[model samples]
Target: MIPIQLTFHGAAGTVTGSCYRLDIGDRHVLVDCGMFQGDKTIKQLNYQPWPFDPRRIAAVLVTHAHIDHSGLLPKLVKAGYAGPIYATPGTSDLLQFMLPDSGSIQEMEVERLNRRNQRRGGGIVQPIYTEQDAQDCLRLLAARDFGSWFDVTGGLRARFWNAGHILGAASIELEVETGGARPLRLLFSGDIGPEHKALQQEAMAPSDLDIVVMESTYGGRPRPKLDDSQRRAVLAEEVTAALAAGGNLVIPAFAVERTQELLADLTRLIADGTIKRVPIFVDSPLATRITSVFAKYLHQENGIKAGAARPFDGGNLRFTRTVQESMQIEQVTGGAIIIAASGMCEAGRIRHHLKNNLWRSNATILLIGYQAPGTLGALLEKGERVVRIQGDEVAVRAHIRKLEIYSGHADHDELLDWLTNRLPIHGSLMLTHGEPDAIGALHASIALWRERAPQVIVPKLDETYSLAKAQPRLMKMTQQSRRLDRYAETEAISGHDWHNDYARLMLQVQHQLRTAKSDLDRRRLLKKMQRILGRGAGTD
Candidate 1:
């Protein structure tokens, strides 16, 4: 029997990039080609060479349209992966706008970085992939319906189950043929959704699997189970409080599901007199385009009738589609609600909105999604008094509030219930896409299952396992084949990196200088720091 090995290229120790490689004999395929988010070191992995040859991969199966799960498709194509990229129709439609937008973001960010580097006498760096590359990759997307088995390669077949996380999110099931009496059945739980998720039905999947690759995004975090109405009520309270504060409410939202869900709830809140009607601006052009995609499929799923009232439409809703329109939003100082994308506040117009509103004492910044560590959202959520935005220091005086009920991932208990429902596994259960604490907590919880639980494995970044019928065994790799050094990977996944430290250091230095009793004292401090830096300049 040929050995089947599974390798996790990303999202092993951290919950950002989510690529997985499946090797069935000589042929290999990818489960996802997501981009790395969070810390700068982790994001640099996007620029690193693929550990495996992309040209050899027979096909790619995409789980969803979120950038963290599907953002690197263009980079993969640019690197010579010409095989068909399989996705659901909804995922395909959403990615038509998302990938290009991601490419554009990359281009714009790199352009700005290059200007800074040029000023500092550093080398220029190109974007990982351009918008044209994203457009070119779109030609390879092949849309497939849910619940239907399709041929992936010579000896492999795959199917998609509704994940209930986002519009086109799915948990993929794969059947790999070996020489045994039956094929190896494996399921990949792609970002399972919580119960009563907005605009999504309950997540569904088939049972009695051999192996399951599941995400542990919210492993140790358990939230109150709120239905649609209850969830809306929670949001209504935040909106009312923000408006009552006499300043604009700025929400950093994901352009895909989170933004649409917020709009739906906000629209309802205004119509029912739960909250006063305010001019709500969807300030992301990508979000404006994605909202239309949701409109197309909103009634199709979630049991909403095709002729029913539009949940995302309202009299006061405005979508800012142009740069001019987005800039015009800066003129509104109060009594308006602004929603922008790049949920973690890593990039996009959200930074601009934050820069404008974060310093206002009356403004409220509502964070409705997960804030990955080291991102601007996480910094704000952590109560950082000052933050650097687009090279400028900004004091954080605005109200930073978080709504945990809106997260799409299933919480700890919910994840356990989801896993327990897929009981009687014949082989190992591997957990990925979580940090050390969350994964460790979930692992400890699974230990209570005693003999009933399958062998649980928490694989690390770039780790490979041999999936034999008896049991899965870890495989050793040559040093040359690993994408990142073990220590480097560990540091990258540790959340905050040197860039975060540098930002904090700069802020501290400025604060100390401003608070110094005299200019002479500040000069002495500066000289001391300069002397220390000079002494260590060439040591490393």
Candidate 2:
């Protein structure tokens, strides 16, 4: 038997929370433990318990340091997972700053919730994890260089290549040798970035794979072909107009990769005198710290090595680490450039800057990344005349500019190009990590590949299909029955109901069954029910 079972724990339908679990015999490895973004229902999913025990996970491989790729590491550690967490050297350094800061924010949020509940005569609420837990996770990190394959489990070797999405982003390839002589190769495109980014090298193309899992972040949009030079030129025009007004320019950027890329571009622009030399302030302490870490790892890749010099040092660039320094930005009467986070303006120092400058006609708000719907940044990007920030309503007088060219993710055409380099002469293909329409667009493009060699599959969230192995007789069992079988001894001794009680016992299983059909639905339902009612008493 080929000892392998794959499950998409997260990043199935939505873009955030990029976790995929692969089981090879007794060893289980999870790829990327990210946090869910936007969609309150999905965000609420973060608070739920894991489907499997965290300790059962042998190790974790992080694709990058973006919050969506590495946010949940601290939570995993807090859950008692004690195993090596693998990442590129740059990702490891960035996480040292990001995870702890995220932990601090989570702790503060929980504290605030507890205090507010106390005012309403309720008890305290514990945070998901503390900064201490994050620190502990950091201790588990083992940094590795890219392009090197390392053994993860029995016959499973993994390697990473440049994804070009962010500073340390990568696409992963895992070769799992079955009990047979032949090994199955799987490729995971971890948020494929734009090909010709100024801050990073173009994404690499894989030669071959048995199974391919690709991201579709920009899958919904048409490919707007623009290289790094084209992107810089477009940005220069915007910066020129914004500075000519002699007011502040606010850029809401992700602290890790986007900020660094923006800084590099600004450096070149200033060096060329295309954009005037003005005070540029980076206001987020976490971003400022991560910037330093990025500097340390510049030699790891061709992109960073090319722009080896400290782009943000000397000149007018200033890193504002203190709240005092952030506040002092208001005193700048002349034109200034401010880069802050969170990228979508959902939270962070960017909100303070927006609040201070939104009503100023001379100020400009530059949006550089995707804004999840319902976020403050999305509203502003959509051209709302006014928005509320920190309880106060502010009029929108600042010029709102969007330079979509600065996106790190690949566009539709670029995605197709990357796929063309990997598809077999006559094999199957699978597409994941994109929205419905975008997935459809990719599906259409897949037809072009099918003309050459037909066999492409696009799966919905929670959907499962059998691999090449022969079908298992166990597929006929109900979900509840499977659940009871897994925990039969405990349920029997504890006298736990295997029907009604189990229905309430496992919400994750219930959710999985709600949309499942036929054999899959039957198995999931039986397992859940039998776990509650005890054995041999149910219709399943």
Candidate 3:
């Protein structure tokens, strides 16, 4: 059998851009041409040359529709890739709105930047891909169902298994055949969701994988043991606390699954009377459109398949799709909840909400997902006394509460456990899509359990690996690979320090409430909390 090779085009040293090239002799399959995110240096990588000629790419396989995972398709198409883009029905549906919306956002952002640049006599910039460029790529998309293996170029066959990260995420299983070598079975874990995730099935752990290319986003620290019940209680308690403060709770969420899951959790809490019902406003137009696609496939066998709705229902829940409706939210004094997007607080309506409420002592900033470094949200989570937003320095007096347990990525323990079940003793695992620290933690965790476990590698951009006897044989990669040590203790995603502590407290309280054994125990725990707050035991 001939030797097959895989190259890391992106998402190697740092998180965000996720691109990989699998070359089987003369044919090439590209997976996930995602955009770069986080700090400026990384974000600029989006404009870099196509590592390999796009025209030579045979096909593209998209695991989901998140901008970081699928944003650069238009750029690829713009680079002259006229290949079939494969994804699930839900992803296809989501991209119908997401891709175009991304284009619009890019254009709008560039326009704003250019106006400022023109005033300063600085060079104007153009968008990476135009709205029309995004539109053109849509015609190339063909939706395929999960569990169905289809023929890709170069005699490769691939099947999608539910990843459970986002609405339509999947772990790709590919069968690679080299004419001279034996067939190699490979699984690509596309941003795995946590085990206790809501509204989604457990991430599929398919067996017999010769090589596993998986994400290690949370590999650095295993999030503290948190159960779904405790997570539910914490959500309820946070809403109650926010309402009790007589101010609106501003939740910065992703427009995709994170927003949908939070809404579903809040709805359940209201139904159970775990928390009082309040006016909930979805303040982003992008989120509103994406939520509609989620609803469209909510009951389909290939879609969300979670037998419920009301995530987008009720008079209590309002969707603000225009600037007027979003502006009107400011008039709300208290007893309301606002969920907004641009999860990182880099842009979108969440900034407006934060600007409107950050100085209010009674208001609460409820963070419900991971915040990459250098983002406005990360600055807030880091306990910065003042943060600049829209050119105005805003005080951070509002109660900033973060719940890390709401993270969609699997933690260190869960990721290792998942690998343990699917990997062989000598199998090679390439860890991608995470900060160096996270990769190091998981890398060590693997050695801790099985001393001779699979070879764990933290690959560098442009690195290449070949398979021989089902084991990875490292090929000569670019000099960048040599600079990134697999065992280095470099820091990646140190996280919002204050935010992690606050989130830990939330999880701790939730655990205590859930494990309270009896009513007396619960009251005693509440009394202790009251004492900590300097409130009388008898007071509410």
Candidate 4:
């Protein structure tokens, strides 16, 4: 019998990228081709050479359309992977705009960086992929319906079940031929959603699997269980307080489900007179398009009821689609609400909004989703008084508030329950898509299971395992096959790299210069730093 192998290319130790490779003999398939979105070292993986040959991948099974989960498709296609990307209809529709938007962001960021590098006489860099590449990759998407088994390749059949995370999110079930009496059953829980999520049902899947791969995003953090009314009440309190602060409220939100959920809640809150309706500007063209997609799927059973009021419409909602229109929001000093992508403050118009409002003591910055470590959102959430944004030093005087009630992913208890429902796994259980602490916590929790628990394995990036009827065996790789060096892999997954340290050091230098007693003191400090750099430059 040919040996089957599984490799984790991303989202093993960190929480951003989420790709997994499954090789059944000579033919191989990819689960998710995601983009890394944390520290610079981690994000650099996007520009590196593909560890495996992209042309050899027969098919790709996408669980959702989040950028981290689907953002690298353009790059993959550009690398010569011409295979059908199977996804739910909703996910396919969402990616139609999302991927191109990601490409645009890449081009814009690279252009700005290249200009700076040009002035400094540094080497030029190209974008990982362009907008045109994203548009071209869309032709490979093949929409598959939920709850039906379909042929994926020669010996693999798959089905999609509602994961309740977002509009088109799903938990994938795969049946792989093992050349034995029975095939291997595996379930991949792709970002399982919380119970009573804004517009989704609870996550569901078939039980008694052979293997299970699950996300542990909120593993150790259990949120308060709140009903829809209570949840909206909490949101009402935050909105009222922010507006009463006498300045605009800036929200860095994910463009997909998070934006739609907030709009729906805001609409209901305004209609009930819970909060005053101010000029609400969604300063993201991608978000505006995604909102329209949400509207199209509203009448489905998995979505809103038949006659519910339009959540993403009505009120003083304005979608700023042009550059000038997004820039116009800077003039609004108070009593307005501005929501922009991306949720983590890594890219998009949100950075502009934060740059404009963070220094305003009266303004409020509300973070309503998970802020991956090393992201600007995490820095703000951690109460950093000063931050560097797009090459400018900005004082963070705005009230930074985080509301986990609106999170789409399942929390500790919810994830545990989701796992419990999929019990009787006949093989190994792999936990991934989380930080080190979260993964440990979830593993500890699972160890307390009273029944016969499956053997657990926490794989690392680029690590491969040989799958068998018994426990899977870890495979050793030679230097040539490794995608990242040992030290680089550690640094990439550590959530903080030298880039973060350099930014902090620069901020410290700036603060010291600003607070220096006199001009002479500032000059002395600069000269001392220069002398230290001169002494160490050649030695290192």
Worst 10 residues of 1 by lDDT: 299-308
How much lDDT does each candidate structure score? 0.91, 0.75, 0.81, 0.91
Indicate the residue-level lDDT of 362 in model 1.
98
Candidate 4 — which residues are off by over 4 angstroms?
304-307, 538-540
Cα RMSD to native, each candidate? 1.6, 12.2, 12.5, 1.4
Query: Candidate 3, 494: how far from true, in Å?
Result: 8.4
Q: How much lDDT does candidate 4 score? A: 0.91
User: Per-prediction TM-score, please?
Assistant: 0.98, 0.83, 0.86, 0.98
C-alpha positional error of residue 77 in candidate 3 after TM-score superposition, expressed in Å? 0.6
- Candidate 4 per-residue lDDT over residues 368-456, each given as its tens digit: 97999889999999999999999999999999999999899999999989898898888899999999889999999999985767899
Model 1: per-residue Cα lDDT over 1-540, one tens digit each: 878999999899999899999999999999999999998889999999888888899999999999889989998999899999999999999999999999999999999999999999999999999999999999999998889999999899999999888888899999989889989999999999999887787788888989999999898899998988889899999999999999999999999989988888888888889999899999999999998998888667532222226978888999998999999999999999999987899899999999999999999999987899878999999999999999999999999999988788999999999899888789989999999899999998999999988899999888889999937899998787687787778778788778888889999999999999999999999999988898899633
Predicted structure 4, TM vs. truth: 0.98
- Better structure of 3 and 4 per TM-score: 4
Worst 10-residue lDDT window for candidate 2 reads 469-478
Q: Write the per-residue lDDT of candidate 3 for residues 394-498, one digit (tens) a residue.
A: 778899999987788888888887887785634688999887778888888888766658777777777888776767777975554443233321322332334
lDDT of 3: 0.81
For candidate 2, the per-residue lDDT at 29 reads 90
Model 4 per-residue lDDT at 135: 99
